[model samples]
Target: MRNRLNRRVAAAASAGIGMTLLLAACGADAIESGGDASGGSDGGVDTSAGIDCAPYEEFGEIDGTTVSLYTSILAPEDQPYIDAFAPFTECTGVTVNYEGSAEFEAQLLVRVQGGNPPDIALFPQPGLLQTIVRDTGSVVPAPDAVEAAVDEFYGPDWKQYGTVDDEFYAAPNSANVKSFVWYSPSAFEEAGYEVPETWDDMLALSDQIVADNPGGEVKPWCAGIGSGDATGWTATDWMEDVMLRTAGADVYDQWVNHEIPFNDPAVATALETVGGILKNEDYVNGGIGGVQSIASTTFQDGGLPVLDGSCFMHRQASFYAANWPEGTEVAEDGDVFAFYLPPIEESAGEPILGAGEFVGAFADRPEVQAFQLYMTSSDFINLRAQGGQFIPPHSELDTANLTNPIDTLSAELLTSEDTTFRFDASDLMPGAVGAGSFWTEMTAWIAEDKADAEVLDAIEASWPQ
Candidate 1:
């Protein structure tokens, strides 16, 4: 707790947000400084009064070693990760060089197959991680210390994400809640409507919104899957959310691995379920044009209509907070907020669909191993959380320190014992099917009014033969 307090003080100073006031906001009782505040050569960097380096001592002085990291998390979001591990360098003399790219998924495979993998790579999808492990046999397993930390800090479900051929190789680093419906609280209040708690209630509320606005001048939902080259990714998220609710996790898992065909009856049902909301002209592209307008509307602008009363709900992930107009307050009681999308009545359980990053290594050098251990530590995770926009999967995270209400809500959902969690399945399938066919076909279905079965069949046929 003392270390976390000191990190916040440091962060506040860095951000120019007045340390004293920030401390007061986060309820930090005191700040502790250690000897030689400028940091010492023996100790990598100046740390809080009592942060122990004994756990990392076994690696035995690899200060000159430079460990490279590659990831899809680009600056400035990636800088927090670099800052979180600065202490590791100060303590052990190992240099951590991180490189992030928008082209991470495509570039990562090329690098590995070309025999140029980084010392460590942060993968946004376990499916991609597994592919590298299977194809190149280059990924190093997490050292025993890191594995133990995984056991102590994270839930069992997280381990499965990093395991390949029964060997634990990576740990989930950050997470985001994907099953949220964003809306304006003031709009709901003025319309005399309550946040729905079930799939049935959600549809009924959508119906009521249309009936309340007879001329169809207003609509119940606004949506977009257009994201430049990543255009139809949002549609894929919708299918995964519905699949989790309607087909259950076990079936979802099978479908992800192609244990079941991509166009199975269950998948068809999930696609149609999404269509009920997205294809219904009365429920989609509000403030824009008809349902066809969604394909041209950028995903970043899809949810903005909620604030203007042109749309009632926008289904998006927690990180969509970044897209809300600059001055908007996204509090539970503020003008706009998000609610957990409800489950289908016949669903097996309340399954939460989300996404996160995993840390995988290509080298097993002692400094590399030591860095991996430190990166996944509870202390480092909490420090990253304080930087905001970073959500740790650690069950031990102090949610009170997480300043964003949306982040806190995501943490609460992730930590709940009863909530079943599943990674975004589209990201878990073979890239040919997951990224290529799935994304392309979904966009065609929405933009061109293609048949659901035809879209699903194209995706199924495109699965790597």
Candidate 2:
């Protein structure tokens, strides 16, 4: 279940043939910025109108030419954009050289370092935007119009992930809710279990499920930690959720922003709590060591049948619904239900895991701004929803238009909850710690008899001071 294919290819495939046409229209120069609008040594565009659509009178056309884009949208997901973008290309002669997600960062970094960066880069990870702001001078400030468009589509807080030091580097793109617990209605009903509304109730329910299963045939939960290059990230989600619930939002923010050490007592407690579930003889399938060995890809799928309706719950991001076995009851009926990971205690308040694409401006051209507006607009959400994609970042997406059950569930979670949503902690961490050290340490904590403090210490030590 590791994503073997390059994500860029998937992104391009999602964008479809419009990508081909866009790529074809590119001029001889790979980094063409069109005309002499560079405005010399000033290094900033005229943001008087901000990014207003009115100033876009000549938005579609750019001095008898079109702008080209290099992006990393996957195939299936990119299809809608491709379809939507065709009109943009036709309306404006601007072309886009859409690239696959594979090695896009490396490719773009090389280009930028070589003095030939793309006019725009659609980065899927938010941390990369911070890197661009700090390391590469390639990214420019957001035009007034782009910021207005972002506020219009996604709310003010939505821009937090893309903004740094009071300047915007990226715009919000598609989003997926991670603080969800998927359960089987039939299994829960057969067991006479009620959906737990509070954290205590949730644990009490898990305990009840375990007590009911005297024999070892049934497990109460399914927890998988496999994600290929990012295997340990799943564990980081659990830790973050628990931290948010047990320690509260202020502490959670500090941890995420690196103001508090990762090895702080609160973080350690979260790790221990998750480890307890893995270590408990009655909680997880295949036990601690077995869970570690279980491929992350198959972990979510394993919860489908639940060993004679014994297993009741699986916690994962919204993307997990797509991995359900095809033609299976869950898959056939779109059988999936999600509930917020209720706060650890009533006093903790509601907390959610929010992760998504962070779009940013590379150049200040009318076509560039227009394309960005189009990509993040409500129209784009509608198009993607029609194709059964997960939740769109724009909160205004009409639930009636969402055909898929998963999309419906995601939509409901967005509007119903009165919680603070935080992006995945690991995703926000530096690459070395996020993808490398964290995974190995978490797996060790589960598989071996490692001390919680030691694990936390190791993670804290790894953070880039």
Candidate 3:
């Protein structure tokens, strides 16, 4: 149920907003397993958690208000958010109606254009936020409180990602490190191989693996690009990682912003660099199938071959730990683990490629703003970090909140002065190409064996004119 009370997009776009959010609409709350989400009746609130309401008392009488949150984060992974919201709701009588969908990236626009967007959206990509803001003019700017929290807790670059056209609209929420290559330490020890620290070293290892195999029974790496509706994103991740290493940060920015064409020599060279492993028959699709099978293989299963001895490495994000089987231990000296996808050249700093979710609000209702503000605070950051898969964006996040070694490593790289951090370029580019042509062309390049230049040219041509 989309509860707007009587407020439409026109009113929500304005600066002044009242309690006209979702209360009058009669329907089941998305987050609740059962029962009508009327929040609470008059003169009462849910105090089951026994949280001090002092912090929430400033929001005025928002006692039975509901704010709907919609995002791509799904079950199991979505549980932490729900768990964290309990304290907030217990303290402030604002019930949060949460919905997670696999089709969020594809269907968000339809909802926005159809005048039924959720009260708040967890945007995986900043580009889509910009697109909706510029095209529809329906997204409300962040409240003063939310903006203040961003200024206090987040870095300047994180703030910049949420601001568009000089207006701050969203705040950084969750983050993940993508510059990781998952592997098994014991397997390496048994095979007498060591972790690679540079691009050249990684390649040498790949070559040695192929030579060792001789018959190509197991390749050096395993990869996949298959994500429903958002297929080929993994390949784009590879492209972004390679582009960062080869073209340098400045060139990567130029390419993402379209200062240089997607087919520019620098970008094409990056593609070639990525292809050296992704396209090379001796390098990828280990344990799964041939290189072409990459198109159909789910990204979740991309790195699984490392466990079965069919492959030695799986290049993926830190979140890949979630894909490991229940009993599979993930540690430096345990059954499986990951290392940074080494720098291309020995330098003072290595580039870190990461992605994060931005909390963008569609309604300016007090309850909506309250939830938005809460999301940006250090309190939420700490609670969210406990959820395991999350890498909170706050500089103030306690190290004790980091639940795993991989997340600790990610937080270290994210905050380390010796590393240069950049958000995923595809997430910052316009959606037509970033989420559209870029994904399709990369899939074709891998599965269809399309020429690198053709893939580049096609993606460049699809950029918004």
Candidate 4:
């Protein structure tokens, strides 16, 4: 509790609004965003966000209402969400009291256990949502209008994530792509190297880079798993990506669900595959240091080496673009760009590894329900998409609303029929393991050179009975 940074902030003030026609077009099924307008007795709500306020009328009057929000997403990544809600607040007169903390997972539970939970929480993953649902008895199920929006816009698999024992409790708020290998396009062009389409090709490129720079400062890969208390999560992402490729989706599910042991032979194979790059002294810590440096370097700084030509590739999510220094170009012909991480064989399979936040409520008040439901709507999502570094998960999201090219690509790939998508495995497992031993053991695997089997055995042993 003492370590938690319980900083409170108001949503970004109302910004220039242009999609005034969106709510007016949600058709008959549009769920009303509850809350009263700041309108006077005779006058209706004023449009500070400059959009039509009619859509919110259905949620009923919520005059001068307030909703409290808590989450792990803090500034600078948090400013966009704050700014995006401007229009919603302007129309609904709901004051969203937001508090973002670094220790959200630990503190959220503390708050709940102490019977002072926030009105809503944007869970980084459903595993925590499951914990709250199964153990805390504090999570409020999604309202009818919220359920209708999800069913109308999302596939069953997404809703299943928030559902526990057949009861739905949340909706996806944002998404990210984890299967990207960011690189310097100009560097690749200068070296006459094309983006690899298969795992073998990527390895060949790695070998080529090593052969070209023998004893030189350049390396084929640079990575870091350090993220404060979340250290080693990046390594877990590496493991999950490898798991999706080597073991395929079915076995991957079984492993995450504990139908198969964490140390199952197949999972060990996946770990070895991850080791091929991450654990390989020849391939990692380019701008950082020795392979062990990966455990100490920050994940946000892990891939920055690409910009300085010290490393050739950094496998991370699309959201990593936000980490680049301001004014850095992120485009095909610009300073940096990302390629889809290749699979073992293009024809064999190329399942996407990804993650998203689930918006769950602790209070069932109409004002809270209104805000949660609005978050799932295309209007809010589309408006939010323009804020950059955000991928709209609404199935009907307008690509035009996405301001960045990478964001557009992520959104397109998310719904593309040609590819398969799966959420992060660590975020899906039980918290005791997924959020615990799995992280600590991975750090040891890199920092101490612990044998893969030993690390796997430790994690498997930690699984709850």
Give the per-residue lDDT digits (tens) of candidate 2, residues 250-344. 88788877888888778887887777666566777623224544334334444564424646777776655545555434321224454556667
lDDT value for candidate 3? 0.76
- Which lDDT tens digits does candidate 1 get at residues 1-465? 223322332233123221110000000001111121123322121234334577788988786878888876643355456666676777777777767655566778889899999899888777778878988899999999999998888777778888998999998787678888999988999999988877899999999999998888789999877665557878888999999999999999899879999889999999999999999988877888898888888777788889889899999887776567667887766878888887884554777788878889999999889888887776676667765555776766665446667766665555444567777887778766666788899999999999999998899899877
For candidate 4, the 10 contiguous residues with the lowest summed lDDT are: 22-31
Candidate 2: 10-residue stretch with minimal lDDT: 19-28
Tell me the spans in candidate 2 whose CA falls farther than 4 Å from its real position: 1-121, 212-215, 286-289, 295-310, 328-334, 361-369, 393-396, 429-436, 447-450
* Candidate 4, 254-351: lDDT as tens digits: 99899999999999999999999998888988888989999998777899999999999999888787778888898767898787777763433657
Give lDDT: candidate 3, residue 265.
Answer: 96
Separately for all candidates shown, the number of backbone clashes (residues 3 or more apart, or on different chains) is: 5, 32, 0, 4
What are the runs in model 4 whose C-alpha is more than 4 Å off? 1-49, 58-61, 345-348
Query: Which candidate should be chosen as best, given TM-score against the real structure?
Result: 3
Sequence-dependent TM-score of model 3: 0.87
When 2 and 4 are scored with lDDT, the better candidate is: 4
Every candidate's lDDT: 0.75, 0.59, 0.76, 0.75
What is the Å distance of residue 101 in model 1 from its true position? 2.9
lDDT of 1: 0.75
